[model samples]
Structure formats: C-alpha cells, structure tokens
Target: MQSLGLDVLFKGTNFLRLLEGLWVSVRISLISVVISILLGLVAGVLMTSKNIVLKAAFRVYLEIVRIMPQMVLLFIVYFGTTRVFGWNLDAEASAVIVFVFWGVAEMGDLVRGALISIPKIQYESAEALGLTKQQTYLYVILPQTVRRLIPLSINLVTRMIKTTSLVLMIGIVEVLKVGQQIIEANRRTSPNAAFGVFAVVFLLYFLICWPVSRLAGYLEKRWAA
Candidate 1:
C-alpha cells in the first residue's frame, strides 16, 4: 500500500488549481462587500428620512431580505432567473448578486442603528452652529457613525469571505469545491486525502478571517477607549 501523504496537493498542478479557486472566492467576496457597502449606505440613509413613502419602500425591502434564506436567494438568482427570464447568468455572478443583496440589507440595518443611536441633541447642536446638513454629516455625524461602523463592517467582510463557500452549490469552482475535487481524485489511492484537503481548507479560511476578527476587536477597544 502506498504511504498516506499530502502528495495529492503537490501532484502536477493540483495545488495551483486550489490556489486559483481560493483567489476566485476572495475576488467574489471583495467585490460583493464593496458593492454592498455602497448600497447599504444609501439605503440606510434613506431609511432614516422623514419621507413616509421612502421609509415604507425600504422597510419592505429590508423585511423581504431578512425573511428569505440566503440559499433560497442564491437558487432564485442562479436557477430561477435562467429558467424564468432565459438569462445565462453564470454561477459566480449569481453568487455575487445574492451576497450583495444580503450584505446590503445587513449593512443598512447597521448603519441605520448607528445613525439613530446618535443623540438628538447632536443634530440640534450642529444646527445651532449654523452647520449645513452636508457639513454636519461630513464633519460631525459621519465621522462618529464611521467609528461605530468599522468594527461591524469588518465582521461582515469576514462573513462574506466564509459565505463564498456557498457558491459551490451553483457550480463555482471555489476553494471548497476544489478541495472536494482533490479528495475525489485521490479517494482510491489516499484514503486520508479528504481529511488533509479539508484541513487545509479550514486553515485557509481561518487564516483569512482571524486577522479581520482581531482587527475588529482592536478597533472596538480603541473606539471605546
């Protein structure tokens, strides 16, 4: 019997393929998070407005996003759109769309909460100082809001990175999918291949997420101090 080793990862271009898959996951997550942040900021600010129609519209959107499961949303974008609209959207694109929708809803709520948490007196004081709305937000409110936002947003980025694994369901050859492929290819020769491959995948995820988590914690402490 051949000795069990992690030779499978190093064989031919297997390891390179895994790295490529990991890069795909990272790329999708980064793009989705950036888009989500922009959309969330707009939605959150709109949500706080006094316009009843605007608030109601965004409220419905928030409720729909919160109520639906992400996997369901993924299927809807990936499968449902293709069947219903005859759109040939690729798996990675669908994954990004679903994640962006989810991220926007979550980040919007965070922004809204941060915005609302500011004491009413702060707004009054800014007005008293003859600060225009734009100046007030730019100089006073937004800075404070961003301090409260950074830690939470960083946590969301980690979530986005981890959640990219779900894209495998729709056939994106992400890291997790590549790991599974490696395990299958060596299933007969190396019985322990699955364990090693998955272990590496776990480590990769941990390595990517751990520092972001630590940064979030550090920022929280620094902000509080």
Candidate 2:
C-alpha cells in the first residue's frame, strides 16, 4: 500500500474532491444528453426531408462533426470564441455547448439511418390500409424507429459521459483534472500517486459506464426480438 501510494487518497479530503469533480462531469453529460436528444430528433426529421437544400445542409454539418476532433471543437468554443467575440461564457457552459453540438450531429445521423432503414414497402402497406400520415408514423413507422433508436441513443450517453474527460482541457476541473491535481500535490511524498490516482479514476469511469453499456445491449436484444 505504501509502495503504491494509494494512501494519498486518504489524505485531507482528497478523495472527496475527486468525487466532486466527477459529479461535475456527470452533470455536464446529463444536461448535454437531454438537450441533444430533443434537438437531434428535430435535426433527424429534417435530414429525411426530400428537399435538396436541407439535405445538403445536414450532410455538411454531419461531415464537419465527423472530420473535426471533439477536443478542437472544445478549444474553439471555450477559448477561441471568447477571444474572438469577447464573450464571457463559463467553462461548464462551454463544455456543454460543444458536447451538444457534437451530440446533435451524431444523434441526427443515427436518427436518419433508423428512419431510412424502414422499407418503402412498409409505407405503401400503411397507405393501403388507409392510415393517414400521422397515424402511419405513430403506429407503424415510429414504433420501429424507436426500437432501433433507444439502444443506440443510450450508447451515445455513455460516449458523452466518457468524452467529458476532455472538458478538463478547457479548465472544467472534472475527474481527470482532479486526479492530476492530486498527483501533482502529492508528488514529493507519494511519487507513485499518479498510478494509484489514475487507477482509481479509471475504476470510477468503468463503474459509471459499464452498467450503461450493458443496459444498451440488453435493450437491443430485447427490442430486436
């Protein structure tokens, strides 16, 4: 124990601070995920429209999200925007904004794929049965879309949670940042503090994400049947 420097976690509220930092990450992720779901639904519907201009715009947005790294997006939103526009956005807010922007694009693509996967024959069958547009959606199309969507969207939540680690670059003081601070503070007395602190951080992240991933898997199987 002494050799590993795990004891440093017991020092003067250090562990508590780590938990607090983790909560900040979780809070940001939850808020962003909620906003992403709402907006992604709208963006997804727009993506399926027959209008060429609208499809082109969404395609461009999706391409930008895919090509640009999330870390770069964070820097642009948190650092560049303030320097360029003289805006005073807080760090947490900036993290949330960057994540939502990314999340919406990804989620929108998922939605588009789910919507398009339903065969045209299904729509034709619904029309033959005298189902109106809304009725067709509510009864036939939406039910299947939701089954495919829920598991994928739940997985996206875990992705967002893990990605929150990047927010530390923008000075959010989330879990990874807290671990760094602890290791730095204990460098002299606990030279191996980095190993123990980081190990714990990894455990915390696993504890949070494993169950979510499992739930997504279970839902995917359950719904597919």
Candidate 3:
C-alpha cells in the first residue's frame, strides 16, 4: 500500500481542490457573519430597550440560543425541522441558518454587555449638553459601543467560521468532508490513510483560521489603544 504522505496536501490537484473547499467554507461563513451581525445589532438594541415587553422577548430568544449546542442546532435545522415542518433546506443553507442563529445570539450578548458597560454618566452628560436622543446614540453611544464590539465580534466571526465545519455532518461538501471522501476512496490502496488525510484537514483549517485570529488580536490591541 502506498500513501501520498505528508506532501499530499501540497500536491497540484489536491492542493487546488482543498483550496476550492476552503473558499466554499469561507463564502458560507462570510454570508452567515454578515447576516448575524445585522441581526445581532438589532437584537442588541432591542435588548436594551426601555420597553419591558421587547426586552423580555429578546431575553427569551437569547437564552434559548445560548443554551443550545451548535451541533444540535444544526441537526435540528437540517434534520428535525425538515422532518417536522416539511421544510426542504439544503445542507449548505441549513448550515448558514444555524450559524447565523448562533452568531446573532452571541454577538447580541456581547453588544448588550458592551452597551451596558458604558458609563451611565455618559448618557447624563449627553442629555446635559442638550443632545437629541438620536444624536447621542449616533455620535456618543454608538462609536464607543463599536470600539468595544469590534474585537468581540471579530472573535465571534472566527468561531462561526470554525463551527461551519460541523456542516459536514449533514453531508455538506466542506473541506473536512472532502478529506473524508479522499481518505475513504484511497483507503483500499493506502491502508491507514485516514490519519494523514485528517492531519491535512487540520492544517487546512488552521491555515484558514489563523489569519483571522491574528486580525482579531490586532483589532483588540488597536481598540485598546
């Protein structure tokens, strides 16, 4: 039995195909992140609303999202919901839906924390200056909230990207799924190829995630400064 060895990941066709899978994962993550950010901002704002009813409703939603494991969320979206509701969501779409739900909950909580962290005195001062409510949020509260939110939200983006790999369980042809396919296909000729293939998959995930992590670190530093 022969194996491609450690070098298989870097070979021509294999490398290109792996990169293609990476791009597909990246695309799904990006779309989910954008949608999540928008939803999170709205939810976060709702969380802080003075109206008791709105706050209570958003609180319940956040609690449910925080309590659920992402894999189970994926399973519910891809399997359970389809069976129960007759909703025929494709795997990729289901993955996006699940991650967006998770990301929004996480991001909303971060935003809530950051918003509440702002000094109460700051609001009083804005009111003292005769600033309108809209002006106060636009010029005062939002800028500061954004600075705090950036690092935390960036971390959430990285998490979402990593979590997208779980979509493979639903038969989405992600990088890990492709690696599984390759390993199974070549296992007959190259016994014990699974470990090598998985190692390559790990590296590919690392390569993709590392830069975003570094960027998150840089943003944290810059925001701190």
lDDT by residue (184-211, candidate 1, tens digit) is: 9888888788877888888888888999
Backbone clash count, each prediction separately: 0, 0, 0
Instruction: Using lDDT, give the best candidate's number.
Output: 2
Model 3, poorest ten-residue lDDT window? 1-10
For all predictions, the C-alpha RMSD in Å is 1.9, 1.3, 2.4
The segments of candidate 3 whose C-alpha lies over 4 angstroms from its true place after superposition are 1-4, 7-12
Q: lDDT tens digits, residues 65-175, model 2?
A: 999999999999988998999998898999999999999998898888999999999999999999999899889987888789999999899999999999988888999
Model 1 lDDT on a 0 to 1 scale: 0.89
Give the winner by lDDT: 1 or 2. Answer: 2
Provide the lowest-lDDT 10-residue window in model 2.
137-146
Cα-based RMSD of candidate 3: 2.4
Q: What's model 3's lDDT at 182?
A: 70
Tell me the TM-score of each prediction against the true structure.
Answer: 0.94, 0.95, 0.89
lDDT of 3 by residue, 147-193 (tens): 88988898888887777788878887878777776776666666577
lDDT of each: 0.89, 0.92, 0.82
| Candidate ranking (lDDT, best to worst) | 2, 1, 3
